[model samples]
Target: MKWVKIKKAEINEWNEKLKATHASFFQYPYYASGYTFFLFSKPLYIKLVNDQQQELGYSCILNVGAFPFKAGLIIRGPVFFKTNVDHRSSLIALKKFAVKERYTFLRVNANEPAIEELLNTDSEFEHKDYFPSYKGSQGIDLNIYYKPFDELLKSFRTDCRNKIRFANEKNYLFEKVKTSTDLEKVYDLFVGLGSKKKFSYRPLKSYTKIFKEGIKHELCSVYTASLDGRIICAAFIVKDSQSFTYFSGALELQNIPAKYSPANNLHYLIMQDCFYKEDRKIYNLSYSPRESGVYMFKTSFRPEEICKPGFYTYVINRKIAERIFSLQGKSISAIRTKLRSIIKLFNK
Candidate 1:
């Protein structure tokens, strides 16, 4: 019945070391959760916990600050999984914090999608059914999900499967990145791809720090696909106990190169190496751009469109903040769509 801000040092031991040392979403050391990616706007993160005794079913949240109009607050995730009644207690505690903090609405977009099983029966989330959804999830989920590699491959489009086989025949080297220096290559490839495709340069140092500190905390990781000792494709993965998301990626030399399109094959590699029959269960490909060939590429993999969750915003008045946030959300989505249109014009 009590909520307290866990000190940073203490928070590390719980989410970083303890969760990491024992169980994690991805087996690779890099996918840990608590590190700061962007240093400029530090997020106030929370771990919904039941540490009063033995705990179960709590979410870890990242408080991403208020939305413009000062009527909304955004949190990257409220990643909650229930293991016991404690989850309900934790959520109730968090609900109080949200209201007392005077945040008109809590905008939550899970880093990954909510599980169907949980939605069918999770009683922990008070506002689980309260918010209107913004979009459907367009990604592959691998948590508690496994099938024979042949079945998995058969599931992909012929072109995708063929690309993997072709890339393999070409003798491309796949290497896992382990150091800060390795990120320079990743950044370069990302920048090249972004420039060629007209997308903004992804914040590399923030990502690098995630990988570096993740290794320390066991949260962030990278994989590079190389040709003749030079990196051609690179991807960074994010993990928690329930999911592994390919967060950022790039390919240097392109024309939809077989070397990079074989990303599904790379995904297969991650399961074999990082997940390796662990409690970990989901692999998320992230949101499909939905307006371009990239979306076709994602859909060719056959990930089902699942209903995704959004953050809950409680308006002091039912209508005021809701309309404002709704408009803001639409405007933001429109801008992103426009940006993607511009980017796709140059995609190789």
Candidate 2:
């Protein structure tokens, strides 16, 4: 087997090949471009081929962090076209590449259980205990698309169904975002929500590039809910051929009543559209802690829990990797413990 570096000009062809696998939007060249532009990470698209030169799989790796401490991250991928392919050989090749490039470690956070099982058995790959927040996601099966819309509505919890009905009764205008002005409005709401919730978000310029490129590729859709000429809620949904993922969203919380439910309504509309119109098979509600209010809201739609093996790291330079991991763990712990205070300082 050999690994070939795919060039920028050949990204579209690579993406087409990716569609043959169980790859998500994260492995797309556009997503890599967005991350590269925002985080200044170098994106490497590497394809694995057999001796006969037939493509077997590919991974979109991001070379991140400063030199001498840099790490390669394969987020949500290293997508293989077939289930029976030798996954171990691919990891071995990737590890060799990382060592040759002088990377401290290589991190993989693939959604595939097969890869996760392989990593668990491999002594070289250590499971990273940090970032435990994304162990699973909530997924709504869109197979009910064949049934009546009312049947799909009935699948949700009573309270959720009531919220959707309430939103409709209030004549909330829910529509697909069409213009840059609409996107700006959505970004403003996203920023406002982040501030209110004491969290951080990517800058608008990054979002602009992601949304623009994703829309051009038919891989993204932004939906908004408006009332009396003011946008109340918005969501960004990224999709592959089979599934639509609710990537990010925001709600205007200024004077909205609990019963108003624009956020819930927005998601309902999105799911409805994805099911009946887009012909998707799954609606991924994204990730949140099981104990969080966000999780409660997402569960009201009665989505099934979809779990995966979390992040794993393969050390290349043992001494450097251990030191970096120790510091990184402490830093992450400190941030989580003092997040509120940090947000306050930033606000001041």
Candidate 3:
């Protein structure tokens, strides 16, 4: 088995035109934002082949540079196109590729249980397992996700059902954002929600670009809920051919009209919209941590908590560099969290 670095355009074709069943939206070229989201990203499209060079399997990787070190993020990938490809050998080849490419470590969110197990027990690699960012994602299987709109309403918790009904009674509007003007209204609400949560929000331009590009690719949709013409809730959803994921959502929980749940109503509308589109397997409600308010709220929707593969990092030759990278990563995260809290306090 051999690992070869292909052109970025080839990666795009492999993901977009070739359409690997196991690849997720994150592996797509547009999703990377071409270094606008991160400082630098190197696209790796490796094909596993024999002496005759017939295609066996392929892995899509984004090697992102974090100043002193590089990390390869494999999101639900290394899909084997042919059945004969050995999972363990392909993974071993990937590790060698990472080290050869001078990456400090490789972080993979593999799609298969066998790949996860290999990362955990393989002697050729050293790694640790963390809760997957995509794990515990609350989602509904569209096959039986809902009934008629009325039955769907009945499925929700009493309080939630009431909130949606109350919002409608009050003439609240649910809209699918289609223009820049509409997006601006939703983005403002999103930014406000970010401030309240105290997490750093991306620049407005970044979001604008993402929305425009995503729309062009038919991969993104924005939904909003409004009360008396004032926007109160907004959500961003992304999807591939099979899965619709709630990528981001924001709303004013406190200032919204009493007994009217704009957020819940918006979610209902979004799900309905996705369902109408036809080819959907999972309606991913996004990641939620244990014991958090968001987790509890998502649970009320009755979506299953699906546990998937998580992050696995295999360090390369530079132990000293790995230590430095690890320290810097933790320190930066700590400082950012503290800073966000400080900013929130001052704003209040």
Question: Top lDDT: which candidate number?
Answer: 2
In every candidate, how many clashes are there? 15, 0, 0
Candidate 3 C-alpha lDDT tens digits along 1-348: 767766656654554542446556665555545335432344566777756877777666765544234556676766676776777888877877787877766667666777778877777555552212222123222222635656766777777777777877767777788987788887788778778888755556656766776777677788887776888778888766666778777777566555877777778777776666545656778766767877666766667656666567676646634453444445444533543454466567
Pull out the clashing pairs in model 3. Answer: none
Q: Which is better, 2 or 3, measured by lDDT?
A: 2
- Candidate 3 lands at a TM-score of 0.80
By descending lDDT, how would the candidates be arranged?
A: 2, 3, 1
> What is the alpha-carbon lDDT of model 2 when measured against the actual structure?
0.73
Residues forming the 10-long window of minimal summed lDDT in candidate 2: 134-143
Give the higher-TM-score candidate: 1 or 3.
Answer: 3
- Structural similarity to truth (TM-score) of each candidate: 0.69, 0.86, 0.80
Model 1 backbone overlap count:
15
Ranking by TM-score: 2, 3, 1
Which 10 consecutive residues of model 3 have the lowest summed lDDT?
131-140
Regions of candidate 1 where Cα sits further than 4 Å from its true position: 16-40, 47-59, 65-92, 109-144, 255-264, 274-279, 316-348
lDDT of 1 by residue, 1-348 (tens): 444555666544555433532233322223323223421123343445455743332233333223322232233344343434443444456667666655544543444343323322444333432233222122233232455655667777787777667767666778789778888888888888888888865366667656765666555678888877788778788666555667778766555454445565666677555445544556666665579766666666666555454443434434635544454445444634543454456463
How much lDDT does candidate 3 score?
Answer: 0.64
TM-score of decoy 2: 0.86
